[model samples]
Each structure stands twice: as structure tokens, then as C-alpha cells.
Target: MASAGMRRRVEAIPGRPLPYGILGGCTEVIDVEDEHELLGVEWMALGCCPVEVWNDPCVGADESPGAPAKKQFCRPTIEHADPITVYAGAECGTMGWSYAEARQHAEASLDLGQQEAVELGFWTNHLAATATDLTPAEGPVDIAQGVAALEGCLAEQYGGVGVLHVPAGAAALLGCCNVVQRDPGGGPPTTLAGNCAVIGAGYSTANTGPGGIPADPGTAWLYITGPVVVRRGPAMTVPDRPGPSINYRTNTQRVLVERTYVVATTCTVCAVAVTTCPS
Candidate 1:
């Protein structure tokens, strides 16, 4: 039979659903077991360079090529460790909670932290660099107008496979549009437009404002792009002590969980298009 403490630990695991699926779909995850790794860089040539005319036959064909040169680069990856600690008093342990339960909480907390970090990185680094401002004129955005503008932006910069990411507010607006369908199992509406799939969750315009402060509540940001490449390096877990150590004097037991990983994007073309709609 399981002890009361063991039962408590099992019960402590929360039933709350996580947002892991959303993260998995939106970004490419590269898992590593080491502290750091190197990621290769490849990009398309911006344009063709003008060809030079050589008067001398001895100038050689190599010296007068009419095409632009293309090159690739590499970058070293750096790892960041995020750690969280949780403690349960000795009295609480006696009441049925165990050190294992505390560890479970710590792990869950770290997982959520990692997800947040990835989301923030995508927004600040990738999306911010290649965004198109589409602030509306004194009213909520019209779905048709918004879709047209998004298509135009993609056509102008990148007209390849893409996905649309919007915050809850913007998603709600999109859901009400006649062009959007609630069921993915069903065929898309006949009037549906654009080449990107819509994901109404896993995004926020908050903390994207100047100085990292939260943006206006009415502000909404949308993203359209090819796959987002995320590279992850080795994740290590370190405990504060080798085994469960109890401090009788303080009547408390504690554990610390440390995790290290690396993540970055490696998209060559205009991988992401940002659209900002104002309230």
C-alpha cells in the first residue's frame, strides 16, 4: 500500500492543461544535451550585382562574372540557465506532502518558464525585426481589410508558406469573421482568403512596447511566416544536494532545480511578417 506522504505527492500534480502544443507548432525545436552548440547560417542573395565589361581578352572570365556572390556564415550558440527552487516545511511533510511533491512543482514551474522565454524571444528578436505596422483608423479592424492587408504584405516581401499568429483579442475578432471556421476538421469557408493557417492563441502584444512595458490593451500584433527555427542545446538539471537533506533546526526541506538550454532562429528569407493593428 502507498504511504500517505506518497499519495499526497501524487495528488499534488496539478490537472491544469499546458500550452506545450502551441509552442511545438509555432517554432522549430532543436534539442541538445550540451551547454552550447553551433548553428549554421544560410541566406538568399539580396540581388544580382552588375556585370563589368573587360576590354582585354586576358582579363579572364573569372574576373568578369555578371552574377552576385553568395556566402554562408556560422555562429556559436550560448546557453542560458533558468532555475527555480521550492520548499515545503517539515511540518507540512509530516502532514503528507513530500520532497518529491516540491520537486514536481519546481519542474512544472521551470517548464512554463522555458516556454515563456521562447515566446518572448520569437516576438522580440524575429518578429520585431521584420514587422509591418497596420494600425487601423479609429475602430476595430475589419476582417476582410485585415486579411487583404496581410496578403499584400506577404506578396510584397515573401509569398511562400506561412502561418498567422494572433493574440486572444485579435483571434476573437477573426473568429467572428465569416471567412473563419471553428472546426479544422471541416473544409475551409468558401470565402476564406490568404495562404496562411490561423492560430488564435500563443501570442501577445503586451511587453512589446517601448522599454518592454506593456502595450496599450487595444493594441494587437499578428505574425505571418514560414516555420520559425528554434535551436535548443543540452538541458541539465542540478540539485542543491545529492539526496533529500533535512534541516531539523529550521524544520524545513528544500530543493533547487537548474536547467540550461540554447534557442535561436535561423530563417534566411523574410521568415516572419509582423502586422500591428491599433485600437
Candidate 2:
């Protein structure tokens, strides 16, 4: 969203990946080609989960685990595998829109805004400034269309769920962020002979096949990341009275894809300020 002049921090996985089960993922599935740098190379965990009504993705409306049960999402996410998968129940509404279209609109809007400012001599005080050179972005005014285009980018590798996940809550999460929830099965983070099997985030909730349609738009997209095998902390350390504390250094990268510079040139005689606007 930064491209749209909207500033946002790309939050990484909250903590070191739990060997066996990590709840959030979107890692290597989408935007791999379109925007490489922004792609959270390390298994991606959506920063925010939008809340809305859900529809069954795995099966039809007739079959579903019905009951108001408050249970944390169950799934597995480990390190070292390859790519993880993310899932969410989608049925019309924003989820029904196109990710590519949304992204494109945001990107183009940002690009034009920057150029408009520059062309109007809004940036560097060079006399060469005029709105005549500014060219408005082409396509639908509704950005969601361009942004939604991203949805199909990796639908193949991740299947349907890989594309988008409308998690458990939608409205409430409108401006919230996503976190990596780890499942504590107390099982070995790995498997060999006597060890436990680490299925990776790919093995997270087995595509529960979407959620049930609700009367209201209260929704949450439970997305999964691509799968990757992670090894448990050396058993030697966690024998009995010891707990393993995995360490990971966080890296921050600031990239400005677009810039807008506003400059004002007033006719010394008029004594009025001339402003530049993107039309």
C-alpha cells in the first residue's frame, strides 16, 4: 500500500517460527513475479485479517462443523521446507474481488500522483513545470479491480486457498494486523527414527474448505503459507527442564517505488501561491 502514498510497515513473523505449527502464511505464493522485493521471502504471515461473512470452500453449505465453539485455528507450520500455503473462505464481497486489480490500481494511482507533482514543477524548482505533460492512469477508478488481479498469480502452486484467505474475522480486522500463531502439539518438531514429523505450514489446517455463510459480514480469513519442513530445536537442549529459544534477527528494508514533490511558483507581482494538483 506504500505505493499508494499509504505508509505501512511490513511486519515480519512475530517470533521465530515454531518448529511444528505456525498459524500464519502467504510466503511464496503471490506477487513473486510482479513485485519481488515486497514479497516477504521468509514465510509470509498476513499482517492483518479482514473480517466478513464466510462461505464453505471445502464442501457445500450442508456439510460443516457447526457449533459456536471458540477454538484457536489448528494447523502445522515448520521451517526448512520450501513454500507454504495460506487459506481463507471466500464468497463475493471484497474477497470476491480481484487482488491483481486492487494492486494495479494502487500502484498506478501512486505512479501518476508522483508524476503529476513532478510535471507541475512541484518538485525541484526548475522552471520546466506544467500539468500539460501529466498523463492520468488508465483503467477502472475502482482500485480493487487492479489489486484483485494478484489473486491468480499463484493460484496454481497453492490451489484455491493459496490465492486468498478470508480468515475468521473480517470487519473487526479491517485495520488490524496478522500474527504467526503456533500450534503446541508437544510433538517432535521433526521426524527420522524416534522423532516426531514436522509437516510445515503447508500441513496447517487441511484446506477446511471455506467457512460457513453467516447472516452478517463478520468474517476472518485464515490464510496459510507455503509449506516448509523445519527441524525442532536439538532434542539435547529440551530434554526435560530446558526449553529451546530460537533466535532470529529482524531486517528492515525501506524502498520508495514512487515519490511526489510539490513546488509552488508565484508571480512575484501577483503575490499569490500557485499549487499543483493531480487531475
Candidate 3:
């Protein structure tokens, strides 16, 4: 028999460590996918407005001042937001978990939201492999040849600065080009012939056409005179608040957390799609 004080001390002694038989885990989470970036021509945020309209300006030979200015009528170009919502959530038993785990979940949810925006930007602008039609290229693309093809189209259309969005496979070929390679000795960086910027996109893919028909993967290379514009509409308004918000729910004594936002993508006429290339 133990004394009263001794019994209290024994009782206070901690039992098995928390989570019983579970082992400790590393704090770091490995990310296998390439992070998405805003690679297109441009980005703009329009709050509350559902549509934007602009008048197309003419660019060509100017008419003689005295010759009665030609009745120049410009067409209005309109861009509308196609709102999309993306969200992520997690639930854990109302008990044991460190704040570290909660932080990880929050970070992952944010990443998913941004990734959705990137994919929308990439697919919004539809382009054809050739000037003739919407058909994509049939096979692997020769980087040099492919670039040249794109240059021709750019010159024919809107010819200022251009950007190329290439998938992993196309990027590999582009990487082998002299333009992308750095000089062994200190020298000026080689420039792509047309003063174009090449961006490698991890999210590039062979998008499906109407009725689920697979389009060409090579069409992944998008040529644009400007940046892809990602617009944020009225933040998904929650009932209680006037802006985007995260809500919580309780189920089976567990808490579920979720967040959401509304976003859209727009492309200008300056963007051209190049589908014929190696996957």
C-alpha cells in the first residue's frame, strides 16, 4: 500500500504518449507538381462589373486631311466574365492536431485556387495550328520551325511583342534551341528572332473539343501579344458578409473548414493558338 501523496504522484505520471501507437512525422510536405504562374499576355481585375467593352482602333494608312476624313466606324469588342468557383475543405476529429497541420491544409487550399485560375487562362484563347483553320498540328514540332510558323502568324496579325506558352514536351525542345541556351563564355543572351518570350507551363494539356473529342496536344503553345488576363469578380459574397469568406460546419463532433472565390479569364484578339507540335 502506498501513502496518499505517493498515489497522487503515480497518478500524475503521464500515460502512453499522445496518439498512443502513432509515430512522429516530418514537418515538410513534398510538392511534386510544378507551381503555376501567370504566363499569358496580361492580367486585370474587374470588381463588380460583369462586362467590359472597348472600341477597336484602326491602324493603317492615314487618309488625307483635306480628303474628307473617311467615315471611320469602329466595332465594339466586349469581354464578359464567366465566373468560376473553386474551393477546398478538410475535417478533423475535434481532438488532437497541431496548428502545423491546419496551416498545411490552408496552404494547399490556396494553391488549388490559383491553379484553377491558371488553367482557365490557358484554355480561354482558342487557336489553330495554321492560318488556314482550327486544325492542330499532326505530330512533334521542330522548335525552330515551330517558332518560325508562329512568327509568320504574328506578323500577319498583331505584330508587337509576343509570348509563347509551351507544354513540358515542347519546352524541352525549345530548351535545346540556341536562343534558350546560355553562352559558355560571358556574352549577350541570344534572343528569339521575333523578340518573343517563351514560358514553360506545367499545366499545359491537350484540351478536349465539343463532345469530348481530344484536341491536339501540340496546340498547347499559345502565342500572345499580351498577358493572359485573369479577372476577379465580386468576391463570392457570403450571406453574412459582403465579400469572399470561409465558413465552418460541425459534423459528428468534427469541424469542417472551407473557402471559395470567383474568378474568370479573358483573351484579346492578339492571342494566337499553335497546336501543331510534339506532345
Candidate 4:
């Protein structure tokens, strides 16, 4: 997405939700603690057809008229929906930047939090596919096969292949075999392995579970498809209260970034876990 990142400037309209329809939800606010925000929240409940079908080839439509009264009542279930939720990041603060320099410094500080949020979302929503289970041994080839297996599992859930969000270390291994490809048009980088498209991102290796896997020594590929809902609130900057001008106090400016999102695979199942043992 480098080309898009460089050439296109996309910004959400302030005070409104930015809907990235890659996931299967909309208008769902997951991080709200208020009881009123939780009221009436619901998800689709798939129903079955009550009428039985005649399997006999000789049965004519008139002779095998199924129950005319049979009906399928499919509705949204109003309950506590388990949308894969990600909590808001802690408020980051910086002190002593001049008034003119505050905004730039604050923006730079926000980078780490934003990366953490991405990592958290990936960790929360991914489905793990490790080397021991998918392949005979650990290596780039095994990880590639793992990617294939993970994509299959993902397709079974959502009936289509998902993209591979790859870590840098894994990408290096996959790249050795020419499995990873750069976007010729300068878009976001992606790798095409088997039926899945892989993307190398900073968030892929965050919190690799109990093994404490880091990006380079281990292999982890997050395969995601189906509906993924990401809701991002705009970043706001303001003067720290007990203001510098109000009191002869420390000159500090605060940048508040509020982001709450549910990175989940709705009923269709969005993500699958794929991993490899340390290299």
C-alpha cells in the first residue's frame, strides 16, 4: 500500500466512523462501557428450513408438495455479541515540547501505540497453524505448506481464501523461494503462496503466545478472510490541563488518540492461525 500511502491521502470525516468493509460488521461500537451502548446490540442468527425435501427422483412436484405451512424464521439475536474486541490503548503523554513543536512530537509518540494496537488486533483475531501440525519439520517450505493449510481452514469457514499477514522474518524465508512478490504498481507488498495472498506488516509477530516467539527466529502467518470490522477514532491534540499558561507549571501538551475496534470474524469466520517453529 506504499503507492496509495504516498499518492493518495485518505482521511475519515471527523466525528464519524470510518468503515473498512473488509470485515463483516458495521455500526458496531465494541469498546463502549456504558450500558446504554450495549442495549439492543445483535447479530444475525441463521435458521434452518423446516420443510423436508423429497430425494426421490420419481417424485413429481405436485405429488411431493412439501408442507405449505413450513416457514424458516431467521432473525438477529439480541444478546451480548462476542465481536472480537480490542481495548483502547493507554493515553500517551509527552512533556517539555514547545507549543509549536508539540504536535509533531506527539504524533511521533503515537506511532508506538498505533503499532501496538495493530499487534493486539492481529493477536486477538488470528487462528494459529503451527509447523508441527501442518508439516513434518520446521523450515520455509513447511511454513509455506502451513500457509496453504491455514488458507484451507479459513476457506472452510468463510468459503474463500484469506490474505496472509506475514512477519518480516517469515517473509525473508518465503522470499528465498520467490513465494513473496512485490507489487509491481507500488501498492502494498503481498506474497502469493498457494491460494492465499500474504502481506508483510509490523504487527504480525506481536505477542506470539506463551512461546515468546519473536519475528525473526519464528514463523507466524495470520490468514484472514471474511468480514473484518475496524473502527478507528481520530487523534486529537490539546493543552494539558493545569495549563502551562494557567500556572507556572511544566510546559506540556497532550495528544489524545482514542481508538476502539472489534477485530473479529463474524458468523462467516474471518481469521485463521498459521505458525512455524523457530528457525
Best candidate (score: TM-score): 1
Give candidates' CA RMSD values in order.
9.3, 27.5, 14.8, 10.6
Task: Pick the winner on TM-score between candidates 1 and 2.
Answer: 1
lDDT of 2 by residue, 1-279 (tens): 246567665633333443322222322222233233222223323312223345545445436657633434523332111111111111122332343333333344443332222222211122211111111144111112211222222232232232122222221221222212222454332211111122223212221212211112221112222232211111111111111111123221111223212222211100001111112
**For candidate 3, lDDT tens digit of each residue in 21-44?**
001010111221322321112234
TM-score of each: 0.55, 0.16, 0.46, 0.51
Best by lDDT: 1
lDDT of 4 by residue, 157-202 (tens): 4453335445544555555546556556554344463333433333
C-alpha RMSD in Å of predicted model 1 compared with the true structure:
9.3
Error of 1 at 101 (Å): 2.4
The TM-score, computed over Cα atoms with residue i paired to residue i, of candidate 1 is 0.55
lDDT of 4: 0.40
lDDT of 2 at 145: 23
Model 4 scores worst on lDDT over the 10 consecutive residues at 16-25
Model 1 scores what on Cα lDDT? 0.44
- Lowest summed lDDT across 10 adjacent residues in model 2 is found at 266-275
